[model samples]
Target: MNVTVKYFASLREKLNLSEEQLTLPQGVNQGDQLKAFLCLRGPQWQKVFQETGPLQIAINQERASWQDIFSDNDEIALFPPVTGG
Candidate 1:
């Protein structure tokens, strides 16, 4: 399926990208799976998506969990947890 992946905050800086269009493999249908697939890109990816800290995901503007499935043209945003002071 094709989806738009967006990065925010530190993730955007680290990846040196704000967003991109992704044509994902059939098996990479869930949020967690997508993250794992991205982690394969290199240590930086793994650190941001898997290791560094707690991450938040939203699908088509709604909050989503790791198991959430994606659809064609879906907009997925991944970012670090928000904090306020």
Candidate 2:
């Protein structure tokens, strides 16, 4: 299935893209699972998303937890915690 991923702030620099269209395998349905899969890409992905920096996810503009299920064409946005002004 195809999904749209959006990255913000440091995450965009880490992956080197603001957004991307991903074609995922069947078992890659959950947000956490998807993160794990991305980490498998290499050091950049692993370090940027795996060990450090808490990344927030929004599924179709709604806040989503790691266990949230993703569907085809879903828009997933990733951003770090926001700070108050």
Candidate 3:
């Protein structure tokens, strides 16, 4: 199925693109798995999926657990965690 993946902030700089439309294999049913799958695309993907700081994820504008699931047309976004002073 096809889904739109959006990148924001530092992630955009790292990935070098704002978004991508991909047709993922059927086994990619969860958010974290999707993250791992994207990493397989190359070094950029690896950075985005890094276990450390900066990156955060949302689904249709709401925060998602790393294990949250997704559907064929789901909209996923990647961004850095927000901070306020």
Candidate 4:
């Protein structure tokens, strides 16, 4: 399936990408696995995924869990943990 992946806050700045259309690879059918697949893109992605705390994931605008299965044309938003002073 294909999906739109969006990065927000520091993640967008750090990754140098706001969003992109992704065609999910075989065996990558869940939120967690998708993250792993993205991290495989390069060292920067690896760093982001490794250093960031628990991210807030939204599938099709609704909050989603790591195990949540994705479908075609899903809009996936990844947000960094909210922080405050």
Candidate number that wins on lDDT, 2 or 3? 2
- lDDT tens per residue, model 1, 25-50: 88998888988889888887887665
How well does candidate 4 score on lDDT at residue 16? 88
**In model 3, what is the error at residue 78, expressed in angstroms?**
1.0
Stretches of candidate 4 above 4 Å error? 83-85
Measured with C-alpha atoms, the lDDT of residue 57 in candidate 3 is 80
C-alpha lDDT score of every prediction, in listed order: 0.89, 0.88, 0.81, 0.90
RMSD vs true structure, all candidates = 1.2, 1.3, 1.8, 1.5
Model 3's alpha-carbon lDDT is 0.81
Candidate 3 wrong stretches, greater than 4 Å: 51-54
Residue-level lDDT tens digits of model 4 in 1-85? 8899999998898888999999987888788999999988999899998787789888999988989998989999999877799
Clashes of each: 0, 0, 0, 0
Candidate scoring better on lDDT of 1 and 3: 1
lDDT of 2 at 30: 89
Query: For candidate 4, what is the TM-score?
Result: 0.91
Q: Write the per-residue lDDT of candidate 2 for residues 30-76, one digit (tens) a residue.
A: 88888888888888788888654788889999998989998999999
